[model samples]
Target chain A: MAGTDDRDVRLVAYADGELDEDAARAVEAELATSAEARRLLGIHRETASLLKAAFPESRYAGGSLPPAPAGRARPGPHLLARPWAGAVAASLLLGCIGYGAGSLWPAPIAAGPSRMLAEIAEYHALYSRETRHLVEADASEAEHIRAWLGPKVGRAIAIPDLSAAGLTFAGARLVALEGQPVAALMYTRPDGLPVAFCILSAPAAGRGMLQAEREGVGVASWGDGTHRYVVVGEAPPERLRHWVGLVQRQI
Target chain B: MADESFRQALTRLLPRLRRFGMTLTGSGTDADELVQTTCERVLGRAGQLRDDTRLDAWLYAVMRNLWTSELRRRRIRRHEGIEAAEAVAGEDGAARTEDRMTLAAVRRAMDSLPEEQRAVLMLVCVDGLSYRDVSAIMDIPIGTVMSRLSRARQDLHARLAGEADGKVTPLRPARRG
Candidate 1:
């Protein structure tokens, strides 16, 4: 153990880049003299790199983020009020006619769809295990749930039949996503794990299916420009995707 | 800080927190939960955050405390132990490709490490925290941080290279020289 500690102490300094000049020089001398020291240092470097590779930061891009309550209003759009000013200036400078400045510069991109899924996953993790206050509309009352949510959500709300996927409709609720009302449908497997479908009225941007895992909850979201749908569950990705496929065809 | 700025700042730090959490929990799901809980706690107690400049370290410490509490709760409950197979990447075919096999093996090896060592290694190696920073975040002596980090790397090497036989002896206690 003493020998192991000595080897580790030298290698840790080298691996962590924390050695002072004298300590570093001494360690370098030892490395040149001893193959075992050199091998250990090599292993330390490899392990650090491998750990970073194994768990890259990007994997947690939208991980388990709570739904932000609401953002404050942006500073007024005085610039947007004068739309033709930029276009007129550009056309005069470039000596071109009909120079549409709106098309000249691209619009800023909104939050990515992955964020929506992460928010949904956060809710899923928070509420899946609850016995009460789970939903505003219980799936046991399927007729009432559909009738209540359909018109309010600004779309025809149908609880997709997932019996083929070994899940049953548990209930439905209305929740806010990004300050907009969204329809949330809950399903449960035989083992009682709750699954949720969060539907939002979003602009038609065909951001195909986006899937992610947050805190053990799996989320898959897709949109057809008019409405976006997210399915949150504890099931495997393929299973969630399979359920989403069926829902997509029906809804 | 303003609520909006605080939220935005906290949002930007999510990836790092999640990565640190992934090391602590050794499960993506638990790590995400840890991140979520940390965010919630931070948002709930925004007024108490005296040093906005040290927000990152403060968040790390909050997450560490929450995880420690969770570990204690799980110990008292004696919950089912984590499965070794769950240490692999999530259940996505795209994520489970042959190219990720090395990562999977490394993750499995990391999962075998003691939670303390894994936490220290990630803070020092991945987050690039100094031993002093790690000591502050982990609330341990600097010497202990170094030894734990060193042991963590050694254990990782042994397990990855197939030199270890499952059991690792504890290092000597930390003391000022």
Candidate 2:
């Protein structure tokens, strides 16, 4: 009982200045008489100082890396942004795939929906389950998001209102796909299921909404005069189609 | 421009975040990568972070969550090839060459700790975070944070005194039949 874990916790918390004033004064009074309490407190404080000393402040800031915007892998700039805009949606089948997220599928360097799915599978990897990190740009600032991404994506992107489909816009971010920038918009259902809608830039390959499934994830894609839209997630087939219809009509 | 405030906070916290990342990942490149990803997540989710929250604590929480997610991806030693961890302090100066040895011992004792203990130690002892802040960051209760810190400090003292890295050279061995 003299040196129990419960006793040590109070002593340690006091030493670390974590206890409130009253608790700390109690620890201090107990420590004033017992050499053992003083000794343990000293040891913990010494260890704390040692940890701080070993890692000095600003050790990395004295003219080191200038805040690299990101350290994620990026390919050469020469590689052009491709037409199939839905790079990340194909991997959003996380609810159904039930495997690990961000698994690198060795999709060969080809074109069209298959290639885009493989390229941006990583977006869904980190988009795994963090509700907050579901997107880069908050949906509240829809106008600014459109302004920032439209030019870079080389198309007039639309922020479709998916509220009728019971989906709320989360946010959007520009993701790289096959060495090109693609816009990935995120929405979530009340049940906390996340769905990604990606719009890619390309020429007039006009079509209406079409339904398909790839790699166990539901996909609905359509191409307009300037971009291809894809909505991907793991949902009932008809439900996926219904959400796709909502996006199609709004955009 | 929308993320201006978050970006400034991130820049201010880069060193500490990177140090914490290094302690967890044990590689400079890996730590920087982890920090950058954490930064992106923080700025990306800037909406979720209310003005009342401390940015430093939020950055740490995001980084810790990212590291945890990565652990699910690859299961192995979290601080692999960390023998070079002490080399980071070498730039402090050459005047205290002996103190550098002490630093190395301290670092080794730290790494030898269980992951849970070491993480709590770094958060509480090194970062000077209150137990409550550490609890919020680690998502554990305040009492748990205190016990872990107590255990980690005690373990570090025991290890560095004579048991670990030949720090004391064992005058006559510390075992008995």
Candidate 3:
């Protein structure tokens, strides 16, 4: 029953205790005489109550809270709490101090194997559940996917065969890593969980196998000095390792 | 503030930060992530924040900025399926009790609001921030904050009332209450 008048805004402000005494008294005076104003004020209170109920902090009490980042304790620059962030910090520390002395540093400080593992896991978390946009190219286009992404990545980007590991090829997409092209092969288990094998051209430093798990996803990165691979999935460590092993042999 | 004192202050703000994140993301899981990211940003850029600045407003601004960038990234990643995912999150086992069902409906309607209105509404109604604080957090004028908050509450009231009436009218420029 309230009109689009200044009193409507004033009534809300007054109800929310947002007004000074003078304006609040003005609203209270209008409320005492105007039935429409009273009803509108009631609606404002009801709306605020509804909003509090809808997004109640008490509803979130049961959920666990992540630990305060160790950055608070560290003397240096504050760091993000994610597991991979620690890895990045370690890599940076080593880079500044000169690792391997005469030998070239064994990893790219910017996006090392651990960083790649973290990134792949995050990608799986975001896009693995998608149906329509699961991949840029479907499984039927395996040859075309290879043809499309292989040259761009400067390597033979083959979609791995994991049939023995209970995964069927879903599709592949050409993604970018550090301004270089990479290929991601998407697969789905019979139970509908997704797995991806990301292939990138890494420098001589980006070699060897590194395994890390984050946010319920198991990630493993390995490369033969020229080509690096990271496999990400929601499976247990053994299962993910088995699948990654199979894919590694195939690729 | 000293590093130890700043960290202690941030620790105390966690619950409010989580609540604000919940309002912005509309998903409990995403809210947790948003809170973590917000804390990380706050600590990482603690030097940038003035000691005299309002810490709560600064934190809310950081969370809002992060959510905006996250939306932009999601838009680039895909088009159709993101909404479906959000829908699934809203209805995920929280509707068993009737009260929870009503709350869920209210949440979905709030989720449908424009981000500006939702931000202001939550800051004022849920977090109980003053209009001046919300204006600072959202980088808008106090007049804009009031108008946005009034419009938000009006829209929410109509949407909830419409749900009870079984009409489910599409949200529009709400008429006078």
Candidate 4:
């Protein structure tokens, strides 16, 4: 009564049996006095009765359930034991894996002749190794690494100077990629965590870069007209952005 | 104790549960899938069901959530596989001849109602659940449940009435040759 409308709300409450003892008496008294109120009550009662009458009967009569579809066996122990069932299951699993792999990897032939594999392999090689002072050039000389690697890949490659990123440059490396040469730059945090940057010429037109993650490692690859670059590391995605931005500006 | 009781309760409720699923989905196949998924989810989280008395509400909530998610996923996949046939014959024409249009329309209307309204209407009208039982199942104050039921009835009445009115006036007449 406090939050509800007096007329419409009271009738609804009365209809739903929500009116308490005194409230019910008051409503009944009102209904006796007001013919219109009684009519409203009648309509409410009729609507409620109609709704109840229209209520759908239970579809699943205890024993009237439809038989399982033809050839679609019930999920019993024997169903799983059947050779055909096993074959069907195996085929379904294989189809799912194949579909996922096809979407992810695409046709290797359609991937175009590029240094993607070599770059990924290089990134894998350097970061996977266990050593200190593993980089040829220290983080302090970010400019030198950019200049040295820029001309070799036939692009103005800039080693994303990320000293502020809490990661120090471990230096860059020249690696053979797709019969042509490319650059693989390495970086690490003070705690000896590693990140790799691989840059080579871009693949053919209409080809998009791919990103993949495996075993907590994120590998992001992209290609501009001149060069394709992949940054592989265990750093948080934001840090990866910093490295990508550094490469983007220089290239 | 709760888990054992919940399992027993679910098994007992399975028949009614399947009926609710069938009414909601309008397809026996889809209903079976919905019931199976609901059972699996309830079984998987058996330990989390603390109150044996509130098992019906818990199961209904799980079923509702699962159905909503399944509908969303189906919307994405519905575009493929039948495109060519659907494109050749328009959806309206195809639906008109199928005898499924009325049921489909009813289902759509029910689905389009607000979740609270739909739940109340479904429980009270479809499942024949008493207002007291609905209040317990929804875990709502009985007054709130009553309000929802009132509003749901009004909305459904308006929808059904509008459909009837639209049908009374024929938009097209048969041509005499």
Candidate 5:
């Protein structure tokens, strides 16, 4: 069935820029020869854009959101707890690289592996100290988290229990880096020290842990062919490696 | 992570998520409810996120899951797809009369699509998600995503073209028992 009418499928792929260099060249070659192909390609592209314009975000923007749920603390203590103390403590314990909003996210980041890593490392630094609403799903809900996050992340989200490492499951949230969604599962020690494990949906070619620390925060990342996993926020690289090992052995 | 503010970021995403809800459930009320439920779910599951950003995609995933379960629970609930069309066809969107009418016609044509195809079309065409993104969100294969997207664009184009040419008359049947 597909072989009969997949010409448009290929055209759509080409239009969406999903086609590889060779496939794209072949399509362009055909487009050069066939006006019909050119027209179809144009129509496909137009229709796709028109379909988008039809559902403008402004059209759906006005509806009110439901009330905030219970148990979601309203950023209370973190506000009153001597802001400087929390700030100083966070740096002392974890020493996350990028401290401020978007200003001081360490220089060596651009020199990091990928933009996803740099951006996610920044996210870890920014939110690592968040005391309230720490996770979208609490540690208690770990059992079915894989079921909830697997399909969204394109694979099973391995929620590793780091209790033996004195790191409780702080929470997990689905965040995006550079427009692609990543699952950020956070863990914290009793002293409120944070460790984040961010998982990207895409697979990797090679396998090994790439460990680094920008200025303060530590990030150790690896891939298992299925998905790329990055362990951020742990210190000294050795402990980071240990946690990564625990995650690898478990998952 | 795209936007700096959390609440503002989520509020920014509501309309888009609501529009997607309209696509899934095909009714304004249901769309709102689904989006609201999604917000509530995200709040209840608040640990699911923090500052990494891309809340829009995550919210869409959460909303899609909520709607899918609601779809299962409701079991064959009738859909008009008009509410979605109307939601988009309102006066503010289209600048000129011809544009508005064309938009309305285009929306109706979209409304006429199979729910799955409409969804694929919306995500690809309207939301600008890649085929792989749509596949992960919809939990379908890339091949399935491509075929559905292809068929949907073809159907929509054909319907609109037929209308413009007056080759096919609009069909509205008498009420059935």
Candidate 6:
């Protein structure tokens, strides 16, 4: 067997049809005399042939073709049948709704943080109850929590002070939202009630303040220039709102 | 005048167009999307199709552009685990299971190559575009395309050969030539 070297690599390249006529011919001449070269060439050809044989047969499963901007319906059926058409349509529709609604909504100062709160509350509900795996890291390791989550989230996040709010900080945990890492701070009031504050880096393009009501949890979210925060709890809207305000001052 | 004619021609080529889109995208959903986007763009710029003879390449160029842009967008959004090709490869049933596996392996190997090499190999080997045509499509010098193709093929050969040893069963003596 010929030792695999730069020359053998080059021969492999030649077999791929990468070389020009002169280069290919030179390699071919070498192959004529070298059994190892011949073996290598055979392997290359067989691999290429196998790949070609595996190339999929194209089938146009028909449905609707895309419409022209002029709204002229093309000769085909409606584009809705095509899966990508639906995705593109959904994206366009969402973009339009977002654009239109964005104009109507006022840029509330508290809205971004409130939404983050809601996300935190939800995260709390899902994982806070777990005794063995309640959080990614325990609250005692506040420094490590910040270090681990800060760079991933692309923003500096300080866990908020909740002792004054009548809750002990149970520590912060890392979570994922829309592929971006988020920071969640869990706290338990004196009565054993758990509350959470979730913070995510604000999208670069910015987003309008979004308020959500899920189950019995009230979430208020607002974003500043650098970060978006959400506060979630079982407390009434006004109470959650107040805690968020305090958190805003501390963080 | 050309716009209407282009639309007419595209309607006829839709099936092959879809197939090419599927092959390139590796996902039926994304392939359909790429084809639709290509159609929309083609329809919008009907006047651009001055040469009817090169319509196939033109459509391919449009599809390729859209796929590249979509990939960039996904990368920027940090949206992971959204592989369109893997999704499509999983959809084919047991009848063509072996073929699908082979193609999937090839696709993985192709993806493992650098972007430049992958593009060159796809254009020349799969798309059956000539070296000259690939040069035109990629907007690179012919020599560059050749070099990339060589590098791509060498890498793919190594990967596929390695895969064959573990995955492929040896042919019986009677079948061996």
In candidate 6, stretches whose alpha carbon ends up further than 4 angstroms from where it belongs are A1-28, A59-64, A71-251, B1-5, B11-31, B44-47, B50-53, B67-100, B167-177
Model 5 score (lDDT): 0.62
Residue-level lDDT of model 6, residues B1-177, one tens digit each, is 376777787877675565555445433434444576567667857665665447777777767766666655553211111122343223356548777777666755654555456556655665566677767766778766655665566677777776778854221111100
Best by DockQ: 3
RMSD of 1: 15.7
Q: Please tell me which model should have the higher lDDT, number 1 or number 5.
A: 5
TM-score of chain B of 1: 0.73
lDDT of 2 by residue, A43-125 (tens): 87888898888766555442122333454322222111232322232222121211111211110101123333455454654
Ranking by TM-score: 3, 1, 5, 2, 6, 4
Off by over 4 Å in 2: A1-3, A62-251, B81-83, B163-177
Question: When superposed on Cα atoms, how far off is each prediction in RMSD?
Answer: 15.7, 19.2, 12.3, 21.5, 22.3, 15.6
- Cα TM-score of candidate 3: 0.57
Better by DockQ, candidate 4 or 1: 1
- True-structure lDDT of candidate 1: 0.60
Give model 1's DockQ, 2 decimals: 0.17
Per-residue lDDT, model 2, residue B26, is 50
The better candidate by lDDT, 1 or 6, is: 1
Q: Per-residue lDDT for A1-251 in model 3, tens only?
A: 44574677787888889899889888888888989899999999988897876665543332222344665522322212222322222221111111122211211111122343345445677779886788999999878998898888678877778999888888988765445566889998878568888876543212324444545676666545355566777866677778867986787
Scored by TM against the true chain B, the candidates give 0.73, 0.82, 0.71, 0.53, 0.83, 0.65
DockQ score for model 5, please? 0.14
Docking quality class, candidate 2: incorrect
List, residue by residue over A35-101, the lDDT tens digit for candidate 5: 9899999999888777776666766545444445566523221111222211111112221222112
* CAPRI-style quality class for the chain A–B interface of candidate 6: incorrect
lDDT of 5 at A79: 15
Model 2, residue pairs in steric clash:
A85-A200
Over A1-251, each residue of candidate 1 has an lDDT whose tens digit, in order, gives 88779767867877788888888898898889999888888888878887777656665455334655344321221211122211111111111111111221111111112233345555667777775867777778888987878776678887888888887877888776545577888877777578888776644222334445434566665545356567778866677678877787677
| lDDT of model 6 at position A80 | 31
